[model samples]
Target: MGLGWIRRRTGHRAAKNQPGDLDMEALIPDHFLCPISLDLMKDPVTLSSGITYDRQSIDTWLEGGNFTCPVTNQVLRSFDQIPNHSLRKMIQEWCTENKRYGIERVPTPRVPVMPNEVSEILFSLAGSARNLDHQGCFECVRRIKNWAAESERNKRCILENGAASVLSAAFDSFAGDCGKKNAIVCEELLSALSWMLPAFDEESHKYLGSKASLHCMVWFLKETDDLSVKQNSLLALKQLLSCDDHTKHAEALAEIGGVNDILFKLIREKISPAITKASLMVVFYLISSSSSAGEKIKLSFLEMGLVSVLLEMLVDSERGVSERALAVIDSLCDCDEGREKAYADALTIPVLVKKILRISEMATEHSISAIWKLCKCASRQEERVLVEALQVGTFQKLLLVLQVRCGDDHTKEKTNELLKLLNPYRAGLECIESVDFKSIRRSF
Candidate 1:
């Protein structure tokens, strides 16, 4: 039985009350419903334009990039949501009257976070915190994180009120003293900082500038066995290192030690697919950021035995993993040392030839680029590297790449250059003649 039955039987506004056949939802007045959620208001709050809504609904709407009042369609002057005490009291009274229909009063929501509250949370996180203090700081940070997650307004409040500086200070405090430090607090703080990184704009650089923070990241990667801490640290490091100014800090990153070792070790360990992808993204950003730092990054990767590991990843079935591996090889092969190492591998030439058009367009470009670099050496100095390419059917692969109509223009251009370079030496490769090299030679 419901209010619909009663309305159908009576069909009049002055009909007697049918409490025995009513729904709690039917008893709630339309004005007491939130426009956004279309539900009975709980903790009703008023916006700047005098439109009222449930606090949770409006906060979620504001956080999701909505700035206008849902009912009036007027642009909001501010995000402030003042409590509608009178309306809340009326809603509560109505719910009480309908208590027999299973209506329960809404509990008062924890006070909506304000700017000063964010500041207080940060203030508690600073200094030499130990034991119970660390636990208390973690709890405070958890509260701020919860509030920020609630909506975009809280995120703005936290960032505008010095959240970044406080996080950096907390990082310093945690790193400065060890007697009270634990992985739980450290991971939570780093994750919170990571969440806020995107919202900080240029201030992100200042927070990440701390050597202690950088060292803490490296320590997390190298020393911690906790999976979550490692992932958060990697994400935070990726966020920081992907910036354009990484060139200025590349030298310092290199000097901090263990960076290359941990990256390669994680790659070889295959901890998880996400961790590996993130590690590859970090390496790609670092190597591709600047030409001046490329050699250093290449040298470190080589010292950490990255060539063999990357060669293994190149064959992975996952396209993203293999594509990133090829990209890394392309960047690593930019230097003479990287070239020497890659050229020495018997599988390197064959794998590069095999990947010509079998993978993505980007992978095709990277593969051709790697072969181009290798053949440049052979064409200029008639080095044995050219002989190795010919031995592994490199020219045959290039001919296939040239014939594929679906390949990108960049791959076609590189293929043409490689064919031209090899044309001069076609007569010397008489050892392997499975295809009509002369026919392919004429097309080139």
Candidate 2:
């Protein structure tokens, strides 16, 4: 008797808490609605006073300077100050859906919640992150991580079904007051990204045959420009490359493009070293993973000195950012024809070679790989510099590195091939010996 009553009460409460799917319409207004009698908003027109009112006579009234509010004939003047909470939620849903499936009807989480309502929910929920008991924080994340590792079904169910709640939980833990930034948010965001990665033959879909995880991503990205969020964004792009859907990958790429703006906004007031570093790293990963997304990224990079910006990242003390910046160079040279020319026509090759040689000297594997890829796309003079640098002692470190991880016979052969291309002269000779050169050659 007790269990039945509890279940009935819970069911009733759940039904009450979540409105029916059609309830979003009530959040809209009749007088504010578009003048077109019977349709949902598609292209909402604007007033001259900068009022972006809906369902009003915008077209008829645009002829004269004296504009009256559509609803109450109020005076109009500034478009910038207009605030439409319903429109925001509608567009928010629009962009989120466009991110996943193709264009579709905008979703309203619970139709007609005012803009203040969303703000309140987000702020209040975000504030909860401040209160995660130390032990509770660790245990919750541990459980999530363990679920991620246990089974594919488990991973997908948690990520796809509970992504919102999980993020809400993550947000609560994100408060700086707790101090477990890396594991709580940064590392977890990076790790959760692997789930969204589409398999070779599978495209991701939610239980409804759609995806909302992106909404969760946008929330985090917009909520905090923290290094963890930026890092997670980068890691997510890196994994997104595995997705066969170019359109989806392109959409994800767009967010990275916005990062440049995010960085400059910081620079406008006061520069942040961590932000600068994270920003460059994200650019690098994005460009590398989405080589084909050329036109979309070109303007942002050029407007932002995308090349020089990355060159600066090399000097950043955070090795991770510097490494990712190197990655950006490799990716750009591969995709953007203009960038390849910029290296030659702009006379940047010597600088690139110098950086490569220095990175090789420092034993930075990521830099070496990036530098090597760039080497493939350089002109003869750049090759000369690379060859000369190798002759002076760069090759020893590279050879040693070759023995470590990328040392298989194929990579070694490729390296040798590149070396010969860089310099046809006798300096390319393997004059030094004793490390199984012939044996390695034989394997090749």
Best lDDT goes to which candidate?
Answer: 1
Candidate 1 lDDT over 1-444, as tens digits, reads: 122211112213323355444432334577788878877788789999999989878878887898798888999998888999888888788667755455666665556678878877777766424333677777878887898887666777788888876775566557543223555566677878877766555555655656766777778888878777788777777776777676655555666777888888888888987788778877876776665565677777887778778887776647777788888888888877788888767778778866666666677788889888877764344366666676667777777666654357876887888888777666667244454343432321
lDDT at position 326, candidate 1: 88
**Over the full model, what C-alpha lDDT does candidate 1 score relative to the true structure?**
0.71
**How close to the true structure is residue 65 of candidate 1, measured as C-alpha lDDT?**
91
Clash totals in order: 1, 10
Per-prediction RMSD in angstroms?
8.9, 22.1
Give the residue spans of candidate 2 off by over 4 A: 1-247, 252-260, 263-281, 289-295, 298-303, 336-376, 379-410, 425-444
lDDT of 2: 0.44
Instruction: Give Cα distance to truth, residue 299, candidate 1, Å.
Output: 1.9
lDDT of each: 0.71, 0.44
Q: Lowest summed lDDT over 10 consecutive residues: which window, candidate 2?
A: 1-10
Q: List the residue pairs that clash in candidate 1.
A: 63-152
lDDT digits (tens) for residues 365-388 of candidate 2: 334444455566656655554554
